[model samples]
Target chain A: MIRLQNVSKIYKPNTGALSNVSLHIKAGEFVSIVGQSGSGKTTFAKLLFAEERPTKGEVIIGDWDISRIRQSEIPILRRQIGIVFQDYKLLPRKTVEENVAFALEVAGAGPSRIKKIVPQVLKIVGLSDKLGRYPRQLSGGEQQRVSIARSLVHTPKILVADEPTGNLDTIHSMEIIELLKRINEYGTTVVLVSHDRDIVNALKKRVITLHDGEIASDIERGKYMI
Target chain B: MSFFLSALRIIRFAFQNFFRNFWLSVITMSVFVLTLITVNALIFINVLGSATVQSVQEKVEVSIYFEPDTSDDIVKSAQGYLLGLSQVRNVTFVSAEDALVAFKEHHQNDAVILDSLEEIDGNPFGSALVISAWSPDDFTFILEAIETPEYQRYIKKKDFTDYEAVISKIQNLSDRIRIGGLVLAGFFILIAILIIFNTIRVATYVHRDEIGIMKLVGANDWFVRGPFLLEAIMYSAASTAIMVGIVFLSMRWLEPWVSTYFGGIDFSAQQFFLDNALLIFGSQFLVLSVLGLFTTMFAIRRYLRV
Candidate 1:
């Protein structure tokens, strides 16, 4: 479950990334947020993970209000919510297996659990064959798959993919989108943020459109409409 | 179990980071070793200076020559009086006959001096009391204590003035060397701190992206910071061990040369280090670790904000 009540994020010197944004989504729903470059799509996703605090309003995930989350509690909140980025954010020196294990490792999981879970998740993301390869040694799609594998390591209740396919080609982008849908079918709530029109139309899920830091539309089975 | 596992992982990461940036770690450790060497060198110089001053002070003694007509009993009584003083280290009573013999031997190389000495009657020289004191400064006090009227009348000469000037010079030189060494040590420590601070900053900067990624991946702040802190301490420990080896090797190599140059001065730098090995090397390691930890914390603070 996720809710944002009148959240407004305004930068210094009168720059507003998001303004008066109110939205809600139930658990286990697949939602796509689409917008132009500065249309506050990324800011909206950032708010979900407590990466950016709203200048004015409330952000609630499951029963906790995270609009003003304490610094110490940020990590606790993050571990429960899987996040994928455009750049894949993999440790360049770490192998694919180590990268996925890192997430569980940070949470103090036992070595046995890490060993068991890392390969399982890597298998889900189709990265089991390249477990020993570093990020640099992998293709963009493989690297993004590794990132998704890491995010899934915790079996997070909610997954937020922020432009996950921005850097991938059509085939790779469709592959990432397919992975998100499969993750959604596993009953994890998925929120995909992107500007790719074809990706959004093809998803045919609940779509929320933003224009100038405000929601322009919210349609069930919405196509890509700017 | 989880806490211990995390600790083990942190230590592992620390080793990984240290070796990953091998050249950077080596350069930082080299600076630490150089700083420690400078500090130890100053300690050696200070110890050597104090020993040299002490050696010179020990060799200085004042001879109080009695008048030629003074009886042996009077000279012997004066010797006893000087020996009874707490400040007097030792007192030797030289008889007039012995003094004459010593004078003749001292002038044996010069015919004119021997001839002049032979011109005197039976023994022109008189008995004297040579006195050594516990400290060079104590000599003045001891001489004053023995300036009684009975001893003063029979005393023909008190040869302490020349030695007093020499003692003062030695003490001044020792004090100057100590103060100068302290100043130099302070300057080197400051430079070392700056160099170490910058080195840590650069290393942390290189890892800023990795730190951000770690934080975003839900790693605890301490989990992110643990490896960097441990790496700093490792560098300190390694540098300290290297410095100890270098210092001991240098002391062994220089010991013979130093002993030969300061013959009979009772100063051995190697012995000094051997005697205080724990205190000297232990304190260096402690100081270096503290410095490294402090700088690492400061340098990584900004990066940890993510």
Candidate 2:
């Protein structure tokens, strides 16, 4: 349900972040975008979310083209895509419940809906008991789960977890990947972008590799074959 | 979202942000209070100076003594004539008998002066007209108005008190206060802007990750920017409230001291502030909020891009 046609991203002074990339994935696919550092994987993920506009080509989702989405429309696009960062981007001062509820709050969800959905998501991430704790009081795994819970508030069609387990231990990383797999199974498109070979191989799902801003390979039931 | 719900949430977030950064808020408010104090104190001094000038003007008058052989009826007619002019605010007829009593009272403290006053068999004092004018400058017009040929023939001396030095000093002080108040207020406003700007920048920097995460979680532009804008307003309101309290207390304490130092010139900053409470506080709140909001918006623009 997502496609990029000859997308290229170049920064100032002739620095090409992603060059001449063409890719597509069907709906309901659990896909992994894998590449080493400076291989344009992050830029590719940014392109999908319109965080960085491509220097050339188009990014289309379903029937809508967002290659040059207007600034005012970015928030609407973002509301449809759930994005998780490497650092587990939770507000430090907010408690677990407040942080999760904040997502619905920003979406203009009513207090009753926020109260109802936040607990459900937090329960799914298995952090219902820790709702009163702030981000600083949570373990790395718990914090990441809060971020995931927040991203799920809108029930977005596509969830992009960019290095979702980048800061976690092996056990924590596996747990996060399992959570993503479960989320994908529920029919939401999951695009997991990471360089971790072990995590990629463990999935045995569709994998797309990027080599210096170009898509090097794509395979169903692929391993971490860089 | 309904506007009311959104507003309530925004206000809640603003208050949360305020208290969460209590020390920073305090410092920001302290700087704001100092700025307000400078402005209010300047207003108070300006008022006091004007009142002092008015009080001094009231004490100044010209006394016109009639010729020794001049009839009492002429002096009374001169009084009536001086009183008719719009420039003259007041005119009192000091009869010969009244002048004699005043001279005796003046020399009562000195035996030699008393003996000389007694040596004069009859009352040596002449009937006079004491005239106070609307302004020091109007004294000239009032004195000129009474110098008609018919009136001048019976006049022996006309004395306007030597208050040139006092009026000149007051004029210089007034000019200095106006210019100095403007210059000082301008300088303080500049400093307040810089400090508030830097404070907002630092506050935004502290919340940079929060903003990024909020946007990532699908917050609209207003959702993300509302708390900061509202926080700016809260800062202005809180500081203004504190300043109002401080101003009231200080004015109350300083009123008696000012009255004593200026010979009871009715130096009442408290009264002045109370009379114009809405104007003074309303304008202060408006200026401070505008400054705060501007700084906050400028500081957050770079972060809101994501």
* Model 1 Cα lDDT, one tens digit per residue, B1-306: 878998999998899888877897898788778878888888888888888888888898899999988999999998888888888999999999999999888888999888777687579988999998988889889888878988888889989997878989987887898888788878977887888788778878888999999999999888999999999899889988998889889989998998899999888788899899889898878877888788888888888776
User: What stretches of model 2 exceed 4 Å from their correct place?
Assistant: none
- Give model 1's docking category: medium
The most accurate candidate by lDDT is 1
Model 1 spans with C-alpha error above 4 angstroms: B69-80
Instruction: Give the clashing residue pairs of candidate 1, or none.
Output: none
The superposed Cα distance between candidate 2 and the true structure at residue B46, in angstroms, equals 2.6
DockQ of each candidate's interface versus the true one? 0.75, 0.74
**How much lDDT does each candidate structure score?**
0.90, 0.86
What is the Å distance of residue B34 in model 2 from its true position? 2.2
Per-candidate TM equals: 0.93, 0.95
Q: Assess the local accuracy of residue A119 in candidate 2 as a C-alpha lDDT between 0 and 100.
A: 91
- Worst 10-residue lDDT window for candidate 1 chain A reads A91-100
The residue-level lDDT of candidate 2 at B42 comes to: 74
Residue B263 of model 2 has an lDDT of 89
Give one digit per residue, the lDDT tens place, for model 1 in A1-226: 9999999999888899998999999899999999899999999999998888999999999999999999999999989999999999998768899889999989989888898999999999987889899899999999999999999999999999999999999999999999999999999999999999999999899999999999999999998887
